[model samples]
Target: MSMNTLKRTAQIFLLACCCLTMLVVARSGHKPAPTVDDAAKVTVSNVKFEPRTLTVKAGTTVTWENKEGSHTVTSDTGAFESETLSAGQSFSHKFDKAGRYPYYCTFHGSKGGHDMAGVIVVTK
Candidate 1:
């Protein structure tokens, strides 16, 4: 190849390698931590859990913000429980174990797996 062609080819090859390296680094690097608004979240509205079911990775902390009525986040297996929360109140629980955690609102819900109840599924 001509000298100019060889130089252009080398430049293009270096550019391609840099692009590929960036892609690999992006794919393998640590992801950004979940922000407050982006974390596993639930809202208590209309006397029910906004998301009746939630799935999250192990060690994630889920927050429940009570927007309307009085409520409580009581665990079925007694893993973690929150005190009664009034309107505009919030609660948070961290899941360290990988399993299903069923919870309910003591003041306005049941533990029979429905009627204001919620479940959190944690995965490894």
Candidate 2:
């Protein structure tokens, strides 16, 4: 083959390889790290909190809505508490500090986090 023909073929091959590399990278299922939003919500159904564990940024407010039955969002450390919430009632709390805040339903769980409990992890 002529020198120019060989050079052209090599260039095309390199371009094809670069395109393939980009395609593979796009299909690798790489996801960006999750960003903390200004607020978060959890659902309180019968005998359970929708998300048993949550992570939020310090100063974010979390709201829990009682969707199914009566419950309470009582903190383990007495940092916060809510009245018994019947279906359609809700409670909100602002986590001002970065620490682990565990809570539970008064009727179904205890301070030690028993059957019906959840935890919030606050980050700076």
Candidate 3:
């Protein structure tokens, strides 16, 4: 074949491969998690809250997912509390007001969040 013809064929093959890859990726329905301005996440593992402290805007919903053992998310001032959660369990709370919300695990922390504790600060 002529050199120009060979080059054209190679270009066509590459274009076809690119189109096929795009088609496969699109068909898989893989998409990134949508970003929410008023949502946050905290991971609970190793007997402690991962963030230890979190700051978010008022009206934001915060979710805590337990990854390791059984625990509780109790508020220091009796504002909110959760039942004992085992591995893979989760809890969520919406901070509607702007203030500090201190929490702890009833099984490992005290009312004042002495041990397994965390704090959530909400702002306007």
Candidate 4:
């Protein structure tokens, strides 16, 4: 084939590939999670989390605010975690999957009756 013809063919092929990739991505129907400003708040107070069980949408960001004591939000499956938060401190995480994410305060414990734990229910 002529050089010009080969170059034109390559350009067309590249454009087609780009269009196909965009079509596949659009068909997959994936959306990014919302910003942290739209997050829900959880209150942490003295070895306890108020509203321990929270339900949110798949793209929601959940913010944990320490109202009265120090604590950490550690996920059971290690999906996400936060450093120790003292009074008035806060941490946020975006939930992108639909499942029950159980978390706890590492300093407190995860077993027995005294464990400080919480659950995040993410829905589609």
Candidate 5:
């Protein structure tokens, strides 16, 4: 081959090698974290929990935001609870075990007699 043709061939070969190396490196790289929006979410109008029940890994932090006014995050047994949170207020809970945990709001449960509840299902 002519000197120019040989040099051009070598350059093209180097470019192809570089492109293949980049593809291999990209394929071996770590991926971005999965955006699991299931665990932490907000409640909507009428004191309802959005995705009221969720399944998550143990030790994952779950947050509940009361977008609907005058809501509470009370234990299913009416034990542990949060006071009425107006619009834009929030609450959080963590599940240390694998089971179904249910909760409700006291304010709506007794007066309007409407129960605003949620469940957290934790697993391995």
Candidate 6:
């Protein structure tokens, strides 16, 4: 084969390989998680979470702001939980799977006997 023909073929092969690599690398792009502004939010007011239950897509983060007093976000199923939040404080959880996670306030429950309870419904 001529030198020019061989060089052209090699260039085409290199371009194809580069395209394949680029496609593979681009596939790693993941959709960003939804935040409180985009996903869902729960407010702890008067010793209760306003809108006690909510549904959101997987990978969404839900933020709960304490409006009354110190509170603890304890997962009922024990998969995950958060630390105690003081008044005007906040807690957040990111749901990664499709299921219902029932949770309550550990601190409040001891004193008020189950004053808080909620569920996170995750969808695809």
Model 3, range 25-123, lDDT digits (tens) per residue? Answer: 898878889885788888999888989999999999999999988999999999889999999999999999999999999999887769899999999
Best by lDDT: 2
Per-model lDDT: 0.89, 0.93, 0.92, 0.87, 0.72, 0.79
Better of 4 and 6 by TM-score: 4
Model 1 lDDT per residue over 1-124, tens place: 8999999999999999999999999999989997633368999989888799999988889999999878999998899899989999999998888999999998877886768899999889
Candidate 5 matches the true fold with a TM-score of: 0.66
Q: Is candidate 2 or candidate 4 better by lDDT?
A: 2
**lDDT tens digits, residue span 2-119, model 5:** 9999999999999999999999989988899988654555464576777777788887767878776787777765435676788888877776777777776766654222466677
Query: Cα deviation in Å at residue 124, candidate 4?
Result: 0.3
True-structure RMSD for candidate 1 = 5.7
- The alpha-carbon deviation from the true structure for residue 85 of candidate 3, after best TM-score superposition, in angstroms, is 0.5
Off by over 4 Å in 4: 1-37, 111-114
Q: For residues 1-124, what per-residue lDDT tens digits would candidate 4 score against the true structure?
A: 9999999999999999999999999988788887645579899987887788999989999999999777898988889999999888999999998999889998886732247988999989
The lDDT, on a scale of 0 to 1, for candidate 4 is 0.87
Clashing pairs in 5: none
Q: On residues 27-92, what C-alpha lDDT tens digit does candidate 2 reach at each position?
A: 986989898588899999869987999999999999999997889999999999999999999999
Would you estimate the TM-scores of all the predictions?
0.69, 0.71, 0.70, 0.65, 0.66, 0.63
lDDT of 6 by residue, 1-124 (tens): 9999999999999999999999988887676686555457889877777777888889898898888888877778787777878888888888889998778888665322256777778887
Q: What's model 6's lDDT at 15?
A: 100
Order the numbered candidates by TM-score, best leading: 2, 3, 1, 5, 4, 6
Comparing 3 with 6 on TM-score, the higher-scoring candidate is 3
Model 1, C-alpha of 102: deviation from truth (Å): 0.5
How high a TM-score does candidate 3 get?
A: 0.70
Q: Indicate the residue-level lDDT of 57 in model 2.
A: 91
Q: Which residue pairs collide, candidate 2?
A: none
Clashes of each: 0, 0, 0, 0, 0, 0
Higher-scoring candidate on TM-score, 2 or 6? 2
